[model samples]
Target chain A: MEKAIRKFWPIFVLPTLGAFAIGFLWPFVWGVYLSFCRFTTVQNVSFVGLQNYANIWIDNTFTHAFFFTAAFTVVSVALINVFAFALALLLTRKLRGTNLFRTVFFMPNLIGGIVLGYIWKTLLDGVLALLDRPLLALDATAGFWGLIILMCWQQIGYMMVIYIAGLQNVPIDLIEAARVDGATDFQTLVRIKIPMVMSNITICLFLTLTNSFKLFDQNLSLTNGLPGKDSQMLALNIYDTFYARSGPQWKGIGQAKAVIFFIVVAAIALIQLRATRSKEVQQ
Target chain B: MKAKKVVSLLTASVLALSMLAGCSAQPAADSADGAAESAPAAQEESVAQESEVAQEEAPAADGAAGQVYYLNFKPEQDEDWQNVAALYTEQTGVPVTVVTAASGQYETQLMSEMAKSEAPTLFQVNGPVGLANWRDYCYDLSGTELYSHLTNESFCLKDGEEVPAIAYVIETYGIIYNKALLEKAGYTADDITSFDTLKAVADDIQARKDELGVKGAFTSAGMDASSDWRFKTHLANLPIYYEYKEDGIGSTEAIKGTYLDNYKQIYDLYITDSTCDPSELATKTANDATAEFVNGEAVFYQNGTWEYANIEALGDENLGMLPIYIGAEGEENQGLCTGSENYWCVNKNASEEDIQATLDFLTWMITSDEGRAAMSQEMGFVTPFDTFTDEFAASNPLLQDADAYIAAGKTPVDWCFSTMPSENWKNMVGSALTAYAAGTGSWDDVVTAFVDNWATEYQLSAAAAG
Candidate 1:
């Protein structure tokens, strides 16, 4: 078996490796290279080192979108994980209709981003309309909170399912042992239940964090970075920079923005995983 | 594990296909800037003359082999075009393809269609930016028969040896209001001769919004940040165009908007007085704005001739299109914003059969009787062709008022904003302008933000493309 595996391993791996290099590795390298160039199409790209990066720092919209996305991710991750964990804990109990409830909670995650955005926009705008107001109004406070509310509503149900798997995997013996030792339910949860779910917390946090940062379709359809482009998120910002403008030259600069975005998101995700993993008990 | 591997491989292959597909742009759609007024007129005599000339040129009785394809920009304008396309196919036995892109998805749609093996032979090349983008692919028409047919030099963009594009139709826009409403409110179309007079009527309507069964003078108060072109690009043109008209030619071609203060005057008017509150406008959807206008809650609508179909469709004969002449002196004669939204350019890479077929179709659309009539009837717009005289929206009272302005020698503003290709400028300016409109941003901040950001973004666009 070992001899046969060794002979076929490379044969099986070569096509995938080739496909990856062509599909991802090439584009990744090209994206980094193009960030320094000034051209419309890839063929016309001329080397202009560091100029694109310089423009990004000075771009007010970039700064705004960055802050907007960071705040959204931080707020969304905390809320989504907490709410999801709570739901998971409740459903994991010997309760009626738990499977049905789990399925319903997970269903929202299946909907397309654009469709969800439009749905939320219509629902929110309709509610606001009843009060003799419209969406994208002069109320700066309203647009900001409206977006946060939208982010939370769309994400909570998705995070709940990830948390359910983690809760289900928690060893029943650990809880029984705590109960035998005269530990209260709250104490058992803190010492045993919560500690065991650390891995799930890490995953849920990462998904929420990354998803929030990379959100484009929802931001586009829900608000379209509208009212004055004040609500423009990072992904939307990169898109507008590339296509919304007249020339193909910004494509390079937009490419640079994308590379930087990847780095930031990757670093944040790594940091979060490391922080969460450290608390996870091996048992 | 096996399924995981399969799915990953499939995902990788699909991603690769998409990347390659994106690189290969569609052929004629990008190049063919379909003239907003490509429809000529229905003339029996002209058709007979055209057919006689065509018969003399080609005695090939079988029109079966000949085919023409046109990439249309507007889906709404397809109603009349269907009849025209069908007529052309029947008369010439040439198949005509009219693929209309949704309202704003023109560029991407154009490129996608162009990359196809069976690319569109005819498409639009509207502005200088459009010319810059698709100039390489354009079929040169310096010596073509179509070159002799063009009467207006102002419409065509020629690169010494080649004519890349021509603005097929020039349109005009302004304040479209109910003429019947105007008469009912103790005013006449003649009374609204200037900006102040028009505003006075609007303000009066606002004062009696409840009494007159109207909610506001202009629907949602005209501050649609999404459709900022109506203000940022078009209405903002009034001051710039006035300055250009005063000199009878543009000063240096490229301007930093010297009369932004005048722009603010009209802009402030749009916000302070409306159906929706200024603060609520940021979240205000477009449908809500137009709905208010159509419901007779707003006496005025700020749009162009393209909206005539929508207006007529609303079944309200009381709602009419008025003049957009804000406050410029001698602006009474100022017509609606008139120019081509897109221009048709034939693809250089297309086959001889395809190219000839496209040219023949274009000529037929411009000169054929049935083709012309169908176009006007559908677009709710008149074609810019010299021989075309059908009033597409003759029943529209608003067009009636806008035409009077045109008759007074107010040459409509040729689309100067098309040069500024940044939705960045519009959106950024829109954000800053909103604060300005709402008395949030100071004049210094507004101008500084506008010019500084404009220059920086302009530089960024140039650097990225350079």
Candidate 2:
């Protein structure tokens, strides 16, 4: 049976491999090549070497977007994980209407990012109007905070589900033993449950980190980098460069920015995964 | 066990075959069937139904004449365009497919569609700057019937002897005022000829707003994406136009912004004597401003003739348009901002037959009785085609007001916003203007964005073009 499966493995692997090459690998490689060329479309390209790369910093908005996105990601990741973990812990315990609460909390994740952004914009703007304060588009600080709140609201539920799964997977015997050994709730959570779920922590951290970094639709639909593009993030910045600015060279510069974006995200994700994987317990 | 093995193997093969079929279906449908069949399948249900009608008619006709796929830019007139196309196809037995891009997404849509194998034979360029990006793809219309039917030489976008694009509509924008509301505020259109009078009247109206039973003199100066163009591009055009007139130039690589002070004054008037708080302008949408005007809550709404449909609830006799006064040198003699941004360009990359079909369709749109009616009546367009006689003139009162201005010999302000560099430049200026209006930033920031960003963006585009 093992021999037959091995012989037919090519049939299983080749289909997926072909799809990956066509759908992702081929386009990715072509995109990287196009980053070095000046063109309106992929078919019409003229090589211009490092000119696109050099022009990336000509506008300071790109740099501003990088710092803004980094700050947003840091704040959102920390808040999302912490709140999601707390919710997961609470829901995991024997509580009334636990399933109901879980469903209610997790429902926000089902809404699309654009829809969520626009809905929150309306809601937040109404609240701001009542307070007689500057609206999200007018105030960069408010825009930033609004986005953070929005990201947390949308992401906490998803992360909570993951954390709940991890908490459940923790052997009941281990938790019981910790309690039997005169451990308090906090002590058991700190020493046993947390260490036991390190793998899930790694996954959650990776997911939240990448998601926050790569956010586009929400940023676009919400403030749209208003208040003089003060609240613009990296993905939105790259998109504006590509679509908002017209010229053959702008497309190449946008592509170059995207390549740089890819590298930064890849490096950060790799480092995070490595650091978390090292801390994960054997069992 | 043997039966279970056979079932598992069969399921695996079926899954792989289905995957391959799914992968191969798209390109095959796209290339072989052409856009008439494929575009509808990919589009919404309404478009799909329209194409099904086209497909039904197509089989009975000869295949000598190529099909027309028009990538329409205006979402507001999409239904009208689709109706016109269907009418043309029913008459001529030619398949005409019209796909309208979502508002604010035309450029991106055009870019992607232009790259497709079954690209749009008929497309549009906003103006000179738009023409620059699409110059290579534009088919020359020098000797074509469409070009011959153009009423004015200036209406054609020329590249030497080649007419690359033709302006289909000539639109006018200014301050659209409700006559009754203006009268209630103790003013008339004649009372506000220049910026000074406009300001005085607006201020008095704001003061007497409660007595007059109106919200404010002007609707809220909305700064959202849907509405910001009114100020950033249209209002901004006044400064650029005045500067160009003073410099005696059509276009420039750098703008001096000599009339920015005037621009500031008009903008100040808009925010101060408005329906809502200036700080809240950032979140106000175009729809909000339109509602205020239509509901008789505001006396003045700054928009264009295209907004006729939206503001038609106000009786035609009650509605009037006044030139946007920005205190220019010949301010009293300044007419409404009049020019064309909607220029039709045939895609040069398309087949010769397709190009001819597109040109024929365009000519038919302007010349034929049903076509002229659709353009003027249904679409509310004041077309530049000679075939559209005075009898076929649009009944839109705002357009008649524009004609009145022209008859009075007021020098119409050409659309200089087209030459105001890139959309990014406009965005930066818009953001600055919004920030300034909201009191979060200074007027100096607006100046820097308008003057400095203009030069930089112009240079960037020039560098790329060179």
Candidate 3:
């Protein structure tokens, strides 16, 4: 059986493995290489290492976007997970309208990022218009908070759906046992139910963190790194660098920025996973 | 797992096969039947698309398939252009196709379109780098019938031996303000000549914004995504373009931003005293800004002349235009910020019959009275044609301002902002300046960014292009 598995392993894996190499692995390797080269299109490229990397550090907007994206990810992850977990707990009860509430809450995630941005931009601008200015008024503080509000509103529902699934599978026998041991309902939840759903929390945290880091369309359509570059996220920063200049060479710098972005995102994901994994109670 | 993998593999193969088959199986005009039906005709068509000197020397279009295509850059200009196309198609009986690139994605569309064998016969290769990129695709038109009518030879793309494109039309922009709002605030259009006078007027209008039933003299200075170019490119050039006005600045040139501090004076006024708070402007988009301006709630709308159709179509004729004087010393007779963001270029790779059709279409569009009039009405500005007239131009007070600026011996500070690889550079500048607009970054940082980073971007772009 082991011999059969070994022989068929490559047979089973080859297509997907080939696809991965072509679609992701090859491109990822090329991206790292391109970060060192300068060219308009990939067909014609000239190697010029260090310059793209050096320019990225000198770019103040890139620094600001990095910090901004980091802060946004941290705040958004915690809020989304906590709020979603709470919603999941509430909705997974023996109560009426639970399904309706879940469906309604998750609807925002169904809308696309660009659409969400435009809708929120209009809504926020309308609200602020009453205060004598619209959204993006004065500067990007409103834009920053507006984006925060948008991210939360758009994400919470999606996370809640995941959390609800986790809640449903939380081994009801354990909670019952805790209750029989003279534990209060709240105590039972804290000790038993919470520990059982650690995996969900980890998943929710990771998704929110990564999404927050890679945010571009919403950022682009909402603030567009507006009030100049104050609200620019990392993705938009890379996009702006690649297309907004005149000479035929910015692709290298843009590629380098993208590579750095990948590294930062991966590192943050690892750290988040580690942190979340430490708290995970193995079922 | 093995069965599932096999099933997925089958599905993936089917999909890949279908996609490749779809691309390759096109029964296009350049199919195998090409050599059989009309070898002599194909040769004749190629001559029409070649240079006119070559056209003069080549065979006639007796057996040629006369076809034309204009890959239009402006979706807004389609209504007028389509009618013009129909008229020309009727006039010449050559099959003409007019395709409009989806708004803001012209470059992507053009590249893919150019790769096809039956590529656009005529399309807008808009600027210097664009022309440079599309060098092979365009047939040289140094001495075409269309080139003969061009009085302003400056807009032409000149190589050592040839000029690739001749300007089809010209448009101008500065600032579009609410004239009634200004009048109600106790000021007139004539009162806005110099920077001092303009500032005085804006200050007064802003002070009594509520009295004028507006939020402020200028709309929300939204430095946001949907509309960063209004500032990053157009208004940002006020200083640089103003400095370059002493010596005529070309479309492909980037001048050092020497008068940047002077440029900041207007930008400072725009952000500081506006109705919207600075922090909020970062998130704000141009749609919000335009909505306010269109609703007649904002006195000043920062936009180009092309916006007149949208503004007027929305039933807001009260909207007027002004130049970006920005309280500069001795700036009374300043013209409206004027230049072409979209310049039309016909494809050179097309067949001779196609080139002739495009040239015929262009000639008729400019020379024909009805065609020129419709274009003017749609555009709401002066066409480069010396004798063209339209109601939209006559009715629009903004055009009057543009005319005054031009007639006063004041050269229109042609917006040189398109000199950059606009989308990429605009975003960078927009991002860098957002901090300043948000009151977080200092002016020095912004200036340093524009000066030093512009050079870096230039070098980066040069290396990439090379």
Candidate 4:
């Protein structure tokens, strides 16, 4: 049976390989190539060397977006993981109505990012009107906090589900032994349960990190980098550069920015995965 | 084991075949449509020509008239364009496809569509700046009958000796006032000829809102994306226009902003005497402003003739337009902002047959009865074609008011907004305007965005163009 499977592996592998090459790999490579060229369409291109990269910093909005997105990612990742873990810990206890609570918490994850942004915008604006304060678009600080709240609301449930599964898989006998040995609840959680769930923590951290970094639809539908593009994020800034600004050169600059974006995300995600995986327990 | 192996092999082959089928289906369908059209197109070629006026230019080579694919820009006129396209296709047996881009997505849509094998044969350029991006794609109309029929020489966009594009519609925009509401406020359109009088009337009505039973003198100067264009672009045009007239130039790399103080006064009037709180205007939409005017809640709504359909609920006798007076020199003699951004350009990359077919279709649209009716009545467009006689002129009251201004010898303000460096420049100015209106920022920010940013954006665009 093993011999037969090994011999037929090519047939199974080729389909997925062909699709990956066509759908992702080919376009990605071609996109990288196009970053160095000035073109209106894919067919019409002329190579212009490092000129596109040099043009990226001519407008300070790109750098502003980078710092803004970085700050948002840091805050959102910490809040989402901490709250999600707490919810998972509480729900994993022998409590009543756990299933109902889980379903209710998870419901927001099903709504699309754009729809969620708009819903929150209207709700927040209504409250702001009642308070007679500046609306979300007029206040950059409010816009930032609004986005954080939205990110937490949408992401906490998804991360909580993952943490719940990890908690459930922790060896029940080990926890029992800790309790029998007069170990306190906090001690057991820090020493045993947290180490046991290190793998899940790694996954949740990676997901939140990348998602917060790459958020576009929510940022766009919410503030749209309003208040003079002060609240703009990296993804929205790159999009504005590509589509909002005319001229062939802007397209090339946008592509170069995208390439830089890919590198930054890849490096951060790789570092996170490596650091978290090293701490994961063998069990 | 043999049976299982046979099933696995069969499934793999099926998967590969399905992928191939998916890849090949689109072009196959596209070709089938072409094949179907070409057959009838050959037989009805002469018949199509015979129905129209005699052509002075020679017939298309080999009499192979091609199909037309027009990428329409205006979403409101989508239905009218579809009806016109259908009428032409039914009469001429030439397949005409009309694809209207959603509002604010035309440039992005045009980029992707132009990359396809079957590109749009007829498309539009907003003005000179827009033409710069797609200049290589525009076919010269210098020798066509369409060019000869143009009523105004200035309506054609020239590329040296070649006419790359022709303006199809001449629109007029100003302050559209509800005559009934104005009279109810104890004022008439004639009572507000210049900015000073306009301010007085607006302030009086605002002070007497309780007795007059109106919300405010003007509808909200909405700062939302849907309504910001009224101030950021249209109102901003006044300053640019006055500056241009003073400098004796059409467009400039760096605007001096000589009339920004006037720009501020008019903007201040709109926001202070308006229906809603200035801070809340950030959330107000175009629909809100239109509803205020339509429901008789406000006496003035700043918009254009294209809004005739939206505001027609107000009786025609109650509708009137006044020039957006910004207190420049000779302000009382200033007419409505009159010019067009809707210029039609044929795609140079399309087949020669398709180009000729597009030209013929455009000619028929301005000359034929059904076509003219659709353009004038259904679309409410004031075409720049000589064939559109007074009988086919638009019956829109706002348009008639614009004509009245022109007849009174008011010098019309050219649409200098077309020379705006980029959409990004507009957005920056819009943000500054919103910030100032909301009191989160100062008026100095607006001036900096208007004056300093204009030169920077122009320089950036010029550099990119090279």
Candidate 5:
């Protein structure tokens, strides 16, 4: 069977390879090339060396957005992982209505980001209005926390399901052995269960990290970088540069920022994957 | 051996068909170019032969040789534009397509649409600043019949020697006051012409808030995207207008902070005398403000002539526009800020046939009775064309007032706001205004966002353009 499959590998692989080349690889290559050039449309391009990349360094908005995105990613990633793991642990216990709870928890993940942003905006604004606090767009701090809550609500359920799968995969015999050896709940969870679930942790971390980094739709719909663009994230910033700001050169500068954004996200993701995967148990 | 022979024959035929498909696509593109070149010569000849009588006979001469794709900017006029497009296509057998971008997304839509293989033949440039970004793609209309139709030559945007775009409609915006409510509150339109009297009436209305049926003197000055444009662009225009008048300059590379203090005075009044709490403004939308005026809860709404249809539905009789008075001297002579930001520019890069089709459609819309009715009656537009009959002018009350103001020789404040450095600059100012209203930011921040940021964005755009 293996030999037969190998003989027909060209027929099987060619279709997928063709699709990837056309859809992803070609556009990606073209996008990278465009970062170093100036043009409105892709058809008309003139190379200008590193001028675009150099300009990004001086763009105060780009730098501000970078820091904002970085801070948001860190907080969201940490909170999402912690809460998702806890929820997974609680649900995996022999408790009543666990399935129902799981379904309810995962429901927000099904909602589109734009819809979720708008829904939360109304809900949060109503509550904030009662508190007599400045509205989300006027206050940067409130906008930040609003986004963090929204991201957590939307993402934790997804990560929780992954953690639940990992929790279920723990060997019952090993757990029994730990119990027989007089292990406490905390000790067993720390020493055995967590180490065994390292692979799941790696996945949940990667998913949350990348999702937080590339967040655009929710950020756009929620605050739209109001209060003098104080709450704008990196993706929204790049979009603004490309479409919102006028002038022919802004397009090239936007492309440059996008390229740098890609590099930063890729590098950080790879480092995270490597660090987490190394800790995964062989089994 | 027989199966192998059949498979080889199949492969050969498939390869030949694929090559033929590739070869057949080029002529379609080439023919489009040929049509584009021939279109202008034919149009020029017809235009030269007949100037005023071109609308009825022109379509027969052109005979819809090419298609028209109009990337429309106005979302409110989308349905009207589509109806017109459908009507033209039905009458002339020329396929006309109108695609309206969602409000506030027109620039992005135009940018993306202009990059397509079959780009839009007709698009819009708001004014000189918007024209700068799209000048390369704009077809010169210096000798076109459309240029001859304009009542005022100054309404067209000229980039050096080329007439790149023409104002299709002239609009006015100011304090749209509810006359019945104002009379109920014991104030007349004549008495509220200047800032001091306007302030007195507004203060009286606010002081005796419970006695009056209305909520306040004005609606909530919403800080969100929809309402923010009123303050950041229109309200800001007052100070800019006065300053320009003082300096005897039309436009400047960098704006000096001349009348920003007056801008503050009007803005403060708007927030102070509004129905809603000032702190709650950041979350309020333009729709909220509109509802207040439409529901008769607020007497004054800062909007434009385009809003006539929406307000008129509420039985807004005796309602009229007042010049935005910010306590400046000689403001009593100021009419409503009357000018146009909407301009039609033909795409130079489009096929000549497509451009010709677009031009003919515009001319017919401006000239023909059916088209003029649709424009004036349906769209409520005060079109910048001499072909508009007096009947069309009398149809819209807001437009009639605008005409009266013009006739009375009140100096119409030009739409210098259209010359704003960038949309982002306006948004920044908007955000700052929101912050100020919410008491989270100071007036200094608003000034910085306006004056300092204006200079910065101007330099940035100029540098980028250069």
Candidate 6:
């Protein structure tokens, strides 16, 4: 069987390899090459060495969007993970109607991002109007807080499900032994349970971090970088630069920004995976 | 030995099967390559099928030669356009497809669609500035039959001798006022012709709000995407129009902030005398503003002829158009801002057959009686064709009012705003205005966005093209 498998490896791998080359590798290579070129349509490209990257230095909006997106990711990642974990711990207990609570909590994750943004916009506006201030009046600060709340609402449940799965796998025998040895709830939670579920924490944190960084639809439908694009995120900034700005040069600049965004996200995610992996217990 | 033989035979069959599967997949990959490289071939196949039907039914039909795919811009008139396309197909035995991009997304959609192999045969540009970006894609319509159908040749956009786009519809927009509400407030149409009178009447109505049992004098000026164009594009036009007149120039390479004070005066009036507190205008939408006019809660609404259908419940007698009195010198001579951004440009890259078909279709839509009825009745369009009658204008109360202004010798403001550097520039100005209204930003920021941003974007576009 081993000999047969080894002999037929090329035949088995050829289709998938061919598909991956066509679907991803070729386009990715082409996109990188085009990032250095200036063209409106793909057919009419002209190479202009590093000019697009140079323009990004003068683009104040790109800088603003970078910092805005960074701050948002940090806040949302913290809130989403903490709340989701707490909910997971609570729901894992032998409480009545845990299934129903879990189902209800998880339902919001099913809604589309654009729909969620618009819904929260209406709700936030109504609340803000009651205080005699419109949502857009609060400027970038209000937009920041609104997006944070929205991200928490949409993501907590999804992370909670993952956390719950992690919690269920935490050896019951060890938890019992800790309790029998006169361990308090806090000790058991801190030393026994959390250490055991570090892998889940790693996954949830990675997911929330990456998702927050790449957000677009929600940012668009909610504030749309109002007050002169003050609340614009990096992804939205890249999008606006690509499609919104009129000049042909803007598209190439937008491509450079996107390449930068990709590099930042990939590096951060990789570093996080390594850091989290080291902290994770064997169990 | 016997077991080894059986195992070897099974492995041989399995290897043969795997080899067969690999061989089968090559064409599938190759075909994808073929599809990407030859979209026109695939499209031609479909066109051939369509032409087969045309030949059986109407062999002599003019539309039989080619197919038309129009990427329409207006979302409001999308259904009407689809109906028109269907009607044309029914009449000519030709296939006509109309795809309308969502509002504010036309440029983005056009860019992507133009990159596709089966690009739109017909598309639109806003004006000269829009034509500048898309000029390379536009076919010359200089000697086409459709060019002769244009009532005014000046409305057509040209790159020197090349007539790239033709304005199909002429639209007029101004401050639409409710006559009954104005009369009830003890003001006549003549009384509110200037900025002072308009302000005075608005203040009076605001002061006596309880007595009148209404909201503020106008609707909330929303700064959302749906409504921002009202201020950024249309309202901003007033200043540009006046400045152009003062400078004695039809167009400018770069605009100086000459009439910005008048621009501020009108903007202040919109916020100060409205139902919404100026602070809340950013969250308000265009629909909320229209509701104020539709429900008779506001006597005035700053919009255009296109909004007539939305507010037709007020009846034609109560509805009237007022010039946007932005406190300009000699303001009485100003009429409604009368121009168009809806110019039809046939795609230069489309097949010659398709271009000819598009030209025929456009000429027929303007010149033929049935086509004119569809344009005016279904779409409520004010066509720029000699074939159109006053009856179409009469149906639209705002257009009728605009015609009255025109007959009285008020010079209609040419849509100089269409020459705005970019949509992003307009958006920046809109945001600055919203922020200024909200007390979040100073007006100097708006001036910078308007002046500096315009120059920067203009240079960038020029640099990009060069």
TM-score, model 2 to reference: 0.94
Per-residue alpha-carbon lDDT of candidate 3 for residues A32-149, written as tens digits (9 for 90 to 100): 9989986544544678868878767544778899888888888888888888888888998889998899999999999888788878877887787677553453357788888889
Model 4 clash pairs are none
The candidate maximizing DockQ is 2
Compared with the true structure, what per-residue lDDT tens digits does model 4 show for residues A1-283?
A: 8987775765777677768887789989989998999887766788998888888887798999999999999999999999999999999999999999999889999988888988998888888889988898888888999999999999999999999999999999999999999999999999999999999999999999999999998998889998888899999999899877767888898999999999999999999999999999998
TM-scores of the candidates in the order shown: 0.81, 0.94, 0.73, 0.93, 0.91, 0.88
Q: Write the per-residue lDDT of candidate 4 for residues B222-302, one digit (tens) a residue.
A: 999999999999999999999999999988989999999999999999999999999999899999999999999999999
lDDT of 6 by residue, A79-117 (tens): 999999999999999999999999988999999888888
The model with the greater DockQ, 1 or 4, is 4
What DockQ results do all the predictions give, each relative to the true complex?
0.34, 0.52, 0.22, 0.50, 0.39, 0.38
Report lDDT (Cα) of residue B216, candidate 2: 95
Shift in Å, residue B318, candidate 5 = 3.9
lDDT of 5 at B65: 84
Candidates 3 and 4 compared by DockQ, better number: 4
User: By TM-score, is 1 or 3 better?
Assistant: 1
Write the residue-wise lDDT of candidate 3 on B70-113 in tens digits: 76777676555556655555555555566555456566456546
lDDT of 4 at B36: 25
Fnat of each candidate: 0.33, 0.48, 0.31, 0.52, 0.49, 0.40
lDDT of 6 at B170: 88
Candidate 5 or 6, higher DockQ?
5
Task: Kindly list the per-residue Cα lDDT of model 6 for residues B314-421, writing each as its tens digit.
Answer: 998889989899999998788888999899999999998899888888888877777788888888888777777665443787888888999999989899988788
Error of 3 at A26 (Å): 9.7
Chain B TM-score per candidate, please: 0.79, 0.92, 0.81, 0.90, 0.87, 0.86
- Which residue runs does candidate 5 get wrong by more than 4 Å? A1-4, A7-15, B1-63
Best by TM-score: 2
Each candidate: what lDDT? 0.68, 0.88, 0.70, 0.87, 0.82, 0.82
Considering only N, C-alpha and C atoms within 3 Å, which residue pairs clash in candidate 6?
Answer: none
Model 2 chain B lDDT-worst window of ten: B28-37
